[model samples]
Target: MIPEESRFESDPEELVELPPTLPDGWEIATPDAGDRFTVARLTHLLRAHESAGRGWAGAGVDDVLLEVSEASLRTRENVVVRDPEGEIQAWGSVHDRAGGRMLFVHVVARDLDERLGRACSDVLVEWAVGQARAVGAARGLETQQIDTGAFADDERQHRWLAAQGFTMVRTWWQMSRPVAPEESELVPDPAEWDGRDVTFRLVRRTGDGMPEEQDLREVHEVLESAFTDHFNSHEETFEEFLHRLRLEPGHRWHHWWLAELTDGPEPQPVGALIGEVSPSSNGPDSSYVSYIGVLESARGRGVAKGLLHTIIADAAARGRDSVGLEVDADSPTGASELYLGLGWETRYVTQSWHRDVPVVEAD
Candidate 1:
């Protein structure tokens, strides 16, 4: 329950307070739109430095730019650490998700002396948690959980997070599938399960390319119902859900699809898939499944499979190099198996760490 008017102040001068204990010649600065390229490059460097044999597929500048642009909405604060020479060396951000109930804190840095690395991480995380508390107070929330993640094999990050009071809570598999030439030859037909009266179709869109209001609502409803039982599920308003996804770099209306059963009195929405084009680290560009879900009543009816196949087919038709998604490794639905069976393979694993922080009114 953040106070309605307690939004994060983004005044750069007020945001760049460096810790007194930071190594001499190191400073902190709030990033702006102009820092996109530099931040992207620094991020790539940090990923490569920390990635343990798991190749880091770094985000593109546009991806970073979109994140920065969306910060006003979701981010409590973000900062970059630089050396005396002004070379960006590290970055951190705290994201307020689900309206300040959950905060995601991320910290990354280039390989540095053990002491300096630890100090820098400590300062950023401390500032991030402080901001998270302010966000919760503004929302009128009494408490919130601070969440963060690290590559499973990155011991340095894992150790740092542990020292910051986080505990490993979940693991995720980042998976990707290369688009096959033959995939384009596959018929673009709705999937049907044996003896199941189920069907799928591209969501109807207006001439302006926006999905019809009814279809959009159905998409949200289907996903909400489908993921109700999922890990860390939380109810977000339809407006929040839609706007959050649209804030990403490649969100487009045509990338949405729905699965419905026509065997009933009328078409009933049972599943939905939303996708976006993304800049790939391995190839030209890729399609990413941002959200895919099937209603509890529609499980095992090929509805989820149908939506996935349709997405792959669409990606192939557009000559995208690959399709990528992240799945909860502990998903009760065993979704990883389905993706693996469909040619997707795990590229890397990341672990989610969480810490419950007490919320108090902002001073």
Candidate 2:
């Protein structure tokens, strides 16, 4: 149990409270019933409060909002907390990704009082678990940032999760590279690699409306070929990827790039780089490389480096301050080494905790 004493005497707003029962005026709702307003409120709460601000510190408000929106659209179960005035104070949602169900809890706002914090979390978890059981979900998951430095509260948070029966399973590193202000260094001069015949272009449908079937087919082939040997080499369908990306608030179509094999039978895309920028927190100031992959046939021909350079130059040209991405610490592709060689630095690390859960029996 969290200590009864308030952690912050200077600010009464900082106290966290856990309750034996729900507070008098709070109500809960499902996403289908106009829950986005609640999500927006909790998002603001998390953004404004320092303690709940770390995981998405570098992300823009618009980006996070889009994430929540996407999740709301996909998940069958979502728990929202609203004050008596019908204003959302906190929320947590579940993502039914791949074969497992992930409980994505975004602690949007917290009171200075510890009791209030505990109360909010207690309700959120209880609701999430109940929803999982109702949906025949076997497992629950959450992502919490682990601090590499002494000043962070990751230890306490981890201990709390363990107390709730979760354990650490895998880890990831937050890496970043500074974008130099001078365009002379990062951009590739056409003269330097002129004869290589290698070129990168953003993929798009020929028409202006909904994505054409051909465009999606290409996205599927490119992503599948790119991550054939990647660390978490699980197959996520094109529809899933499309839905997920479109759900992101800051998702921009042009940020996705494809390297076409100029000599190939189909002018096929052999490598791809996907990126996004936040308009809320990163303040429309920085771009983040969300994912990148190079097809097996395209691996050794400077495709990866060329794609990275292209993305970096694009972000810089767009006036981004820094570029960020995550690399598996144990990736066999030596991706971390490549990023390091290009000047990206490690900020810290985070672990992925997972446990095999027994499937719920069908009635």
Candidate 3:
């Protein structure tokens, strides 16, 4: 991943390190290259937190690295806290996500004392609150939205966010579907298949090995249009959309797919699916559908199913263990029902917590 320091552009409010918000005898500052222990512990904190909250841990080593990498620093700020004894106690990262939404990853040491844990959570959240205002002010937004998520079963996390004025806004089912090797032939070659006048194929690429600009734009437009009426929909520029997706850990160009109605006047793009290569430590890697959208106008025309079928077939052909995707449980289009019919099962549940804070404008 390449780093671009120009992205955040915090100017005067560039997140001054260690603002003395943490308590005495606790070291709080942004992570640096010299602190390998701090980085390793942060990854442990995430895995341990997920394991305890849900039934399993899915964030792999690479996934954790991307969270704290230099490239990530372009749009994210991270802080790590260590005790006077030099033991890392907590770590947090705040991402200046699209529009006015800021994503906070609040991870505290699972084995710390209950009192210390609360203190650490408070420190992390306070820092995030400040960062949110800085980003909102930079973007000239009146209301900054703090978006954080936690496993549905984690009562502790719920309490922490609730106490911080965040309300549970949505529930998501993280679903997975196993792909048998024989399922590779499930679809007759995505490139050549035109099912019901809707064609399913990978996003076109040029000789430069980069996705075609027109195709990329179409995919972006399809998703933006698809989710326009959904919950908490926000307008994200094409550049912002492309930049964020490229920062994903397992991001790849080949994983992107688009569906278009071939019989239409000039073949209109109606559906899109952006996938990620999920590397597993023990087995074949999986294919994760990071973003999948079918236009509301084309919903009943089997566009969504065609895209799903193409991904399943592609995963099987690639020898992946499974295909994973997240679906909003309260989707207006009954999306969860579609996945349920396609051999997917819910492995875990997550909830989105949001708090809206006014932009902390410069005095």
Candidate 4:
């Protein structure tokens, strides 16, 4: 509950009213840098509760805090709801991605009565869509799209998104596999590369572990080309791609790897795999595959398999507990089959929803 005197005072245009389902004392305010810890705690609690029936893992406090910090810097709008005692009950934000052509909204709320939950989500969704429209107008674009996701088992979230005019666009599999202590044998030996003149190596870094510019550029090039035909693929600038990945917690230069083929006139960069360490809710640290791609020309040459083996072996060497990744369930490349063969199993599924916003022209 927000105090009477400390209740947020904002321009009438910016002030979003609490839904009638909520208590009269509830207040809405924009969070600042100082609210990182509180926001993270609230996010973790809400996600944990929501994930119970979905079988997906909730994010750790460190990762949530990093996300909050980055959102405060990069997003177009962010807001939070507080109870009468001033405890954060819900948080939401809208990120304008791909230069305002796409808006991604994230809303998390603590467990409450169904009516209150729906009311809280409604306010956030309305505010997020309004922000998206403003961003589209500023960019002079005719229209923009709003995107959000919900776990397959979370019917309440699905209903809220449907009521907001978002349609389910795609489904994804969240998969994970345990890292064995002696998995080095699982990695293919160098001699096994008989017919395919391919090699896998970690991205070169300086003494301080900063990636070399050339290798980093090659990584971006490979991913851009490989994902050209992928589902919902978009053209992201090299700077945006790198900056987004670097903002994640436990992102390290050493976690990036590349696969090259010497059979070409010159060494050809065929595949790239980037990983980050995540604190698991169960106990030990886990390795997450953030991005993995192989060029179309290199698909049949086992480049993708090599990159996966390299990451798995590295995680085993570092004593990480497991490796996790998400894959497009409808991918034409049959990526899920590859993970299945390597012992990865589906933990849960999530659906992506999209809504298009009409742009407002200036008078």
Candidate 5:
């Protein structure tokens, strides 16, 4: 039998110095895939954490399990604080998303004693910092960036993150638009929408049900160039881009789309949209606009609206409840106006927090 103490993680001795010491009967241990009780506790903790922050629970068991699953253990790790009886009271997860970007998740049980809750928060944040250092050093980076988020109304989360050296970096507007069954007829099948010489349609697929390499490459190129001027824009290689997107539970091949300028002698791919299926346990599933971009040259045209219409129609055809997306609340383009004109409404708002810390040099 694997000892619970060492079951989930093997901390890097060089990066992690002086282990955490918790007060009360709380104990620190990483989560293990084989432990059913720990997994249940983690799911509960995630749900409770979101509910406390936004007035309703969003993440379910499957979503929590996906992040900590055996397959995902390669680039992600999770730690939790357990009571004397082994029930989890706090949780944290770290993902080495890129060379210097480490995605972090921190959650403390909302119902615990106030004093103990703060203690748990401290330990979790400290662990996250150590993990950042370990990840950065391994990547040969001089500094590592820890990126985390919280609901707009989550003051407790804000306070904890601020106390630990994290600063609010950005605010995002989460918006959703209802999809009606009748809307399916608006775009019709083969959804090749066109306006002002711009064309929007799904990415081509080969007979083997795999996407054509050229089309996929075009999609990536279009998005990369389109977002060059956007906030916090970071260059991602094609390999890294596909690897991360494919890992998402919502990723779907048929949902990929492209916008093209056909007035030229040859079709020029100038925009792309990657849609995913957002599963719902208690209601009809929704379609999420994971990444949507239109080249600056094609902005004045209706490329973006056409891409959105295709997704909305596709969602309607699939019997989805709504279409959802997140946008930069303070975007220079004032893109929120366009979304609002198209019937999208803010459902909730979220904030991104970031901490840049020095990495310990690897031996």
Candidate 6:
């Protein structure tokens, strides 16, 4: 068995004289069949290092594991680190979507200090840069929401990320509320639609992977059309959307809803909401709204509020204590207001750190 001591060292000041390289006995294996071995080893060590990892409070190693697992399934060439004894200890992956490539990294478990962690992260960043270069991307991007409380639990992670040249480029807020019997008061009256011809519907898939292709297509179209003007809105292709969702451990076909224009002979969906349930290491249970969108024409019809309610109800039905979602504090659409009006209070502020790795200049 690989010794845990070597992987959980707390030396934040490990000298950085030599540039970071792959750990001993670790090899950068090709993509196609890397998941089985890498995921098993990484998951085991990460759970073992639960409280020992730097970012324990916010964005726990478990959270990062979920993020990386989903990312690996969406992105290609997922690079993983293995010990001399063949146990995986760290990893990161990249997904090319929305006209750009996104870099995702997470430590399985490490015996290193702040400076050393930064050095180790650099290896992954460099690899991402190279991958972006190979893909002809104009710039490379990475995202981390500071409000996730990751910084609060592990100041070293924030310091190290900033030291590595990432800059704050966006911000969001996490909000939530208890499911009360009178929660409907927070929403516009469905009865108010008596004069209007529009109707709303809660949509779900048949099974885990058996989503209605047409509904998925409609939701994607609605999302693309709706969020085009929103901050950091990127047009994710259907393939990319499917790939990302498939990566999610708790992704369910029933975890979506679509709103339609009722006047049409065939209901024309114009809005959508996507969410997922995640296992919590700290508490009983929780769910999160990953994405929510409504077409420009569908915005004022109470569709957004209705969809939120549907998602909350779904969470409650699943025995989850609370539902969580992030929204831009200054959204042009005033989304945070909608969330707040519905009794969801700000739990934490999330700042987005970004870096532009411009394409290499041609010789």
| Residue 363 CA displacement from its true place in model 5, Å | 16
> On TM-score, who's better, 1 or 5?
5
Residue-by-residue lDDT tens digits, candidate 2, 30-119: 433335555456556655543442444433355345545434344433455666777666666555443333434535355525555556
TM-score of each: 0.87, 0.73, 0.93, 0.87, 0.91, 0.72
Q: Who is ahead in TM-score, 4 or 6?
A: 4
In order, the Cα lDDT scores of the candidates are 0.73, 0.57, 0.83, 0.73, 0.82, 0.58
Sliding window of 10 residues with minimal summed lDDT for model 5? 1-10
Cα distance off (Å), candidate 2, residue 192: 15
TM-score of 5: 0.91
Cα lDDT tens digits, model 4, 324-357, are 9999999999899999999999988889899887
Please identify model 3 stretches exceeding 4 Å from their true place: 1-23, 33-35, 361-363
Q: Could you give candidate 6's per-residue lDDT for residues 268-316 as a string of tens digits?
A: 7877888877677676467778889988877788778877877776666
lDDT of 2: 0.57
Model 5 C-alpha lDDT per residue in residues 1-363, reported as the tens digit of each score: 111221123453322332344555667776886777777888888888889888898786667777777766767888777888878888888876766788889999999876778778887777888888776777678898889999999998998899889999999999999999998976756357776798888888899998998899899899999988997676676866776687888989989999899999999998899999999888999999999999998886888888888899899999998999999999987688889998999999999999998986457
Q: Choose the strongest candidate by TM-score.
A: 3
True-structure lDDT of candidate 5: 0.82
Better of 1 and 6 by TM-score: 1
Better of 1 and 4 by lDDT: 4
Task: Mark the regions of model 5 whose C-alpha exceeds 4 Å error after superposition.
Answer: 1-9, 12-21, 361-363
The CA lDDT at 146 in model 3 is 89
Q: How do the residues 123-226 of candidate 1 rate in per-residue lDDT, one tens digit apiece?
A: 66766666666666766777767777788887888888899898999999999999875676454552322225766666686898777888888999988888
